[model samples]
Target chain A: MADWLSPAEWEAVRLSLRVAFWATLFTLPLGVFVAFALARWRFPGREALNILVHLPLIMPPVVTGYLLLLAFGARGPIGGFLDSAFGFTFAFRWTGAALASGVMAFPFMVRAVRLSIEAVDPRLEQAAATLGASRPWVFLTVTLPLILPGIIAGTVLAFAKGMGEFGATITFVSNIPGETRTIPLAIDLLLETPGGERAAARLAGLSILLAALALVLSEWVSRRVAARVGGR
Target chain B: MLEVSLRHAFAGFTLDAQFRAPPGVTVLFGRSGSGKTTIVNAVAGLLSPDEGRIASGDWVLLDTDRGVRLRPHRRRLGYIFQEGRLFPHLTVRQNLAYGTWFAPKGAPREDMGRVVEMLGIGPLLHRRPAALSGGEKQRVAIGRALLSAPRLILADEPLAALDEARKAEILPYFERLRDEVSVPILYVSHSASEVARLATTVVAIEGGRVIAQGPAAEVLGDPAILPAGAREAGAVLTARVAAHHDDGLTELDAGGIPLFLPRVALAPGSLLRVRIAAHDVILSRERPEGLSALNILPGRVQDVRPGDGPGAIVALDTAAGRVLARITRRSAEALGLRAGMDVHAVVKTVSVAAADIGTSGAG
Candidate 1:
């Protein structure tokens, strides 16, 4: 495999893996919280909140990137506030690429986790409460353990989506070597350059391998968690 | 001890109940949807009642009038749901220990070894609750409750989800808890037989209201209160095994009457409480001879109450406390069965099955 791919192809492969890792890591906790809220809570503007969480999936990838730019760009209101408060910037940076990837993958994560949370029996929480577990304890002990399979599945889905995220990442954070240039962006660049067919092919192969690995990991983790919880 | 007086209205039903029980097994007996579980939940601080006051011993769990309400975990009460409700991910030992994790540090810990032994769950300690049989799960659930060292245990139809064989398998453990454990228990059930076997006090509920509350014997024996009493009203008698005859019979000394039962393994001097259904009893003006029934006790009719249908229930005051006999109106009139009338009550020895006889302390 090393002989088949050039040095640039390998760098692209490494960059894609890093971007996917960071994207999934950044979104996991927020995804879980949003999934739980959507599954278990009823509040004002709940429907609207749900729609907003899922909007990235329905809208075109380029449109989602534009919206992210307006809200999260360095000069935008939220971006300006975050930049002033935390001295952090996302525009045209690797962090911006990760944010775009995460936004593109978020719907998949939330849907998977939410479905699992809904599948869990609420009676178990009530039982925990009767056994002297407070609300947080019950959630940590009962709810979290029961929905672990879903968490794993959602993570894998988000990670795979992040690895292949193209339109949003390219639109939000322009491709830059050793910065925001992920494998999909490299593949797009190679496809556009003359005599870059071999590099694009190698990048495509790496993407396929990573996607397969993610699928297998998801299945393995889900089964392990299911066994731990006595689920079939 | 528990004192609960509560009123709550749901969408279409209202629950109004008031009762007090001493330190023993007080059963909340009622049909489905009669709000028995609701009352227990209120006492456990799981549900907030619109108007109520609940006290276990000296601690006030809930007092709506004073705007006092304790959280469920803080109430120091153990609850056993119908389904056992053991944590699926935890082993039986872990599940049992889980209760103690939140219990007050200085509170007395009930003997864990004794509880495990009593419930016969020693072999299941390392296994998950899902791996155990229905009976074993319930036993573990009971042990978990006991290990918490609760001030009072509230069981909401703990046997309602089990089969008959499993029910029988777990009842003796409950009996042991009632007799040996110092903590009071509020047992919920709709089965008369379960109440007869387990309860020291019976609180009958119907249509979300408590209809009667008293000693198990009085509550079960009263013909006017229970529908079962009108058709099958009977008195529970406490008797000691006197002797066992070779011909598949055991003679018990129930007060002055020699109550004969089918062969049982109980040793002589062992105490038993027998429930003789009123329908199985026969009333005669004089002692009849050559009858198939083996139990013939001579007593005087204490009260003759007419039932709704075509029968009358005669309360008999024998030397063995009070016994109820349900006789047809025709037979009652023919025998001049009335209060203060002398009569002989005949009970078929075989009709009183072994299942109807429960062994308890020397009552």
Candidate 2:
């Protein structure tokens, strides 16, 4: 497989996996918290918060990416603060691609988790409270375990979206080879290059195989989680 | 003692009630939507009453005027919900241990081994709640609450979700808990039989107010106040197992009167409560012989309260304590049954089925 593919192609595949893994991992906790709050709590501005969380899903991927660039760019307030205070940067790097992908996939993750949270019986939580568990303890022991399958589904969906991200990654990180170019970006490059049809076909085939594997793995994992949670 | 006084106004209903439950199983008895559950919720700290105070033992759980409201967790009350509400994600062992894991330091804990054994849930330790039957789930829920080391246990219609057989299966465990466990229980139920079988104190709630409250015998003996129509009203008698005869009869000493019923499944020393429905008793001015009824107790009629119908309820102060007899006005007139009149209260042996009997304390 290494002999058939150019080193650049292998690097894109590796970078895509790394970016997707990090994007999914870093945003999972926030996704659960936001999803739980939206699903269970009632407060003013709840609908607005819900709309804001879903904005990236409804907007074009390029627009989300552009918004990310404007807010997290080198000179932007958040980016500048992080650069000066934490010696960290995200502009035009693989880290920037991960951020873009994570933002783009967040809505799908939150929606999945929120639905699961909503399905949970609040009476169980009340029972937990009566049994001397504080709110946080109840969440950790009961609520989290009950919603594990949904979280797994959400994480896998986000990872898959991150792996295939094109518009957001290109707009935010500019598709630099090895540094930021992922499988999709590599395929795009191959398709545009002169007499690159065979290479483009190979990359496209690989992308399909990878996406299918992710989906199958996600389904298997979800089944195991649902079984462990004793959910029907 | 558990004292609760709360006032909460819903859209179309207002719950304003107050009652004191002594150290024992205090049952909040009423019909559905009659504020039994509301009072239980208030006592459990699950609902914050608009204004009131709730105290269990020495702990002041809630007091609106003093701005002292303990959260449900901090209140340290074990609550068994109607549907069990066991955590589906956890095994029985884990669910039972959940409350103990979070119990505050120095909180008195019920021995887990004893609870599991008494509830007969040892084999289900490794099983998840989904695999358990309704009765098993409720047993686990009760065990979970017990292990919480709560100051009080609040059971809100714990048997309401179960079938008759399941209810029969779980009732003994609750009786054991009531008799053996040190924690006082605040149980809510609409079933008169459940109250008669389990309650030491009965608070009859109706339309958000306590219509009657006293010892189970005192509250249950009056037919007019029973939530169930007079037809279902009965007297709860606390009796001791006197002897089990070879002839398939178990004799119980109710006060000093020897009452015989179908064989009961308890040892000779055990205390039992038998519910004799008002309609099951027949009154005679003099002792009658050759009657098939196996039990006859001499008593003086204390009061005769007639209903709107042709039947009248006669309260008796017998050697077996207080008993009620439902007879027709014609019979009352023929026997001239009145206050302070001596009579014989006759009861058939088979009239009190196994379902109408429960152990008053641990055997």
Question: Using TM-score as the measure, which candidate wins?
Answer: 1
Q: Reference contacts recovered by each candidate, as fractions?
A: 0.48, 0.82
Interface RMSD (Å) of candidate 2: 1.6
lDDT of 1 at B40: 91
Q: Give a tens-digit lDDT track for model 2, residues B1-363.
A: 888899999889999898999988999988899999988888878888899999865789988999999998898888999999999988999999999898987877888898899999999999999999999999999999999998888999999999999999999888989988989999998877888899999999888988999999999887568665567778888899999999999999988889999999999978999988889999998898989998998999988988779988998988777888889988898888889999999999999867679998722
Q: What's the C-alpha lDDT at position B81 in model 1?
A: 89
Candidate 1 versus truth, CA RMSD in Å, comes to 2.0
| Predicted complex 1: CAPRI docking category | medium
lDDT of 1 at A155: 95
**CAPRI verdict (incorrect, acceptable, medium, high) for model 2:** medium
DockQ for all models, in order? 0.59, 0.66
Please provide TM-scores computed only on chain A for all of the candidate models, following their numbering.
0.95, 0.96
Name the TM-score of candidate 2. 0.94
Runs of candidate 1 with Cα error greater than 4 angstroms are A1-4, B227-232
Q: After superposition, how far is residue B108 of candidate 2 from its true place, in Å?
A: 2.7
In model 1, which residue pairs have backbone atoms overlapping below 3 Å?
Answer: none
